[model samples]
Target: YFVGIIILPTVREMEGREGESEGGTSTATTIRRLEIEITEKRRVIKREQAQLQLLEQELEKARLQASKEAVIASQCVDEWGKPTQWDDTAHEVLKGVFKKKTFRLHQLEAIRAHLSGEDVFLVMPTGGGKSLCFQLPAVMPGHALTVVISPLLALMQDQVYQLDLVNVLAATLSSADDEYEKRRVFDHLRSMSNKGKQAPSPFLLYLTPEMVVKSKELLAALEAVYKAGNLSCIAIDEAHCVSTWGHEFRPDYRTVGQRVRSLFSSTPVICLTATATFDVIRDVASSMGLGQHRQGGGKKMATFRSAFDRPNLFFDVRYKPQSNKDQLNALLQTVQDCTEKFGSSCSGIIYCLSVKDVEGVAVHLREHDVQAVEYHAKMEVGARKRNFELWMKGHVRVVVATIAFGMGINKEDVRFVIHTTPARSISNYYQEAR
Candidate 1:
């Protein structure tokens, strides 16, 4: 169908110059109008499809909750623990739950800090099992509610889905969730609240910072959890945003830091990010009230740092000094090399600096028969999510994206990550590429 549409230009449109057409109305202009109409219609279809998928997801979630509640009622689930020391049992539990036989050095360190009840500033490289750092501690036998403030809805969903698979009882509050979904999650929290030492399940509630600040109802619910003495830890993923460069994306992040402290004064808070400078490190600690600046000034802070090294990745700097055309050709050559190294089926993400650049690169790549999709902040949220899923599923080979494209994306086999324009900083580049 798309091929037919591409090849169906009117005779006058092909024969005439830029503006000339039959009846003094340019056929080219008519074609462009039709193309735009088709694009708008496609967007409508995608939106409807996304809504349908959301309904399906909500229904499936409800079913899962029903099944889980039944099991909880039928059996005695071990409530979470509060370990004073990192023990062999905890290690064995992690290995059993996650199907891993060993703990990475960084994982053990992060777990040790959590066991000690230290406010942590964890900076591990991307794909470095950082989620485990927070998640493992959540299952510790304790009356600790771990609230994870993630940066994006997609990220929250991904993390929750992973925990859900392990039967660890994670839930999220987000705009993407319908009322039914939200209510189910709230019910779980309410059941856990004021139960003294008995939590129905080990709960990890994920929220976007925007939701944290704007939702009065959510804030009230969090207060209930805290009042129940179940509020154990607050973790901020993509922790870079709270301090230095991330305020533009969500300024309310700072507000979240303040609110969490006010709500749970003694709760251990951890901020985990893969990107930050030496200076940004201290700033993050200060901004989140860690180290000597912790609320009461007596808490110890574990600033766990993992080396940001990828031995498998080879980094290079290429210069295209001639012209825009030359630079584009250089990019094509690199993409061609990747296509050869990996099969045509391999996927990649191409980073662009601006929305217009994303469009331009996507058009050019598509023209050259590279299955490319465009994603930027300017698009509707549903559209952006759809495009991301396309690339993730290999329906599209490349996503020409602006800076906000790849946060918390779990695709591990992205064969290439190309930065057509250098990001504002090296930190940003490492995050996208990683």
Candidate 2:
């Protein structure tokens, strides 16, 4: 039997029909929810795309960095494979067997390379053992005669004296030496040459560029020696002077590169300088004809830079008062204080702005019981040398002068360097400080 059900519309059916009549409300709500979900998904995808772009950029940067590192590594490896050696005798000489304290490895290497027939440029600081670079190689086992072109007479004289102290056969070709002494040196060289043997001792001939240019006989003799393979190398000291744009421009240095190139084409050249900026170094190398191919086509020339810092030196700056007398008084007081503290054991130099100022201050110091002397171009060469000698010998504690006083002097124990007037540039200041 089947249960009979009444087919009648109730209250719930009536309510559902009323709701559906309101423009399909359930369908509109469902469509709106779907639109919101799609918008959120699109935002998430856009953020992910941005992150992917950033990752790609980082990857590209890493690749470029790797390529740069590879290039530098390859350059270093090439440098490492270059042929180089140290002269055993020179090493022993520098290793304190000769009573010389401290040895620079780069300086030794530069000398050895030059002796072994390679052009070199030693860019070292002042008092950085530059003399050893050439002096050591001069004594090497060869008929090698080293011709040194010094920028100043005093520097040449100092080198000769130092060599003499070491019992090395050294001579200076300057106008100051008497004719008899000059002839004696020339005859000695000639006798050695006639014997078909190296000179009794290594002969280091020191000459200025101007002297080298003017003396036809000297030039001929040097050229002959160079042709005979007796010339070992030509060292250009104070090589920065070769650059016309440098702070210390020497007109004589301009012709040095051309002369060396013409006369000593096969002989190695060593260019040395205490202070040279990056541009100065490049200009010096170019001026010396060592920009490209060096002697013997060996490894490329290297530059050894020592730090310019001098820990022993104290840096200070004092603003000058409006009154010149006040400034002078203040400077005098400082000099007096330094002298009283350091006594005869210390020496000092005071740099002035002008020649007149130099003279005035030096006179004032002399009058005030400060043993000071003046040095300027206006002074005779003899006077300058005397003043320098007096100061070096500790007879004078203070030297009140222009910038001309410090160049080529190796007074290492100078207690202080004062500039009554500020230096023209940082390079000038650093040179004086060194």
Per-model TM-score, in order, reads 0.70, 0.72
Put down candidate 1 lDDT per residue, 1-434, tens digits, no spaces. Answer: 45544566787877765454463676677888999999999999999999999999999987886565444322311211233356675687687777777877457766776666677777778888888888888887763578999887657766776677778878888776778978997887777676556565578899988888999888888888878878877888988888755534457887787777766777788788887554565677777667543455875566666666789887767776578777777888788899999888888888889898889888888888888988886887668768776776678988898876767667666788888877877667777778
Instruction: Give the clashing residue pairs of candidate 1, or none.
Output: 80-141, 80-142, 81-140, 81-141, 81-142, 82-141, 145-232
After TM-score superposition, what is the CA distance of residue 341 in candidate 2 from its true location, in Å?
Answer: 4.4
Q: Each model's C-alpha lDDT?
A: 0.75, 0.73
The runs of at least 3 residues in candidate 1 whose Cα sits more than 4 Å from the true structure, single-residue gaps closed, are 1-85, 164-167, 176-178, 194-198, 244-250, 291-297, 318-332, 363-369, 393-395
lDDT of 1 at 169: 76
Top candidate on lDDT is: 1
Rate residue 271 of model 2 by lDDT.
Answer: 83
Q: How many clashes (backbone atoms < 3 Å, residues ≥3 apart in a chain or on different chains) does model 2 have?
A: 0
| Candidate 2 lDDT by residue in tens digits, 341-416 | 7775688889887999998888878888888988786787668768877876778887787766655567766888
Number of the top TM-score candidate: 2
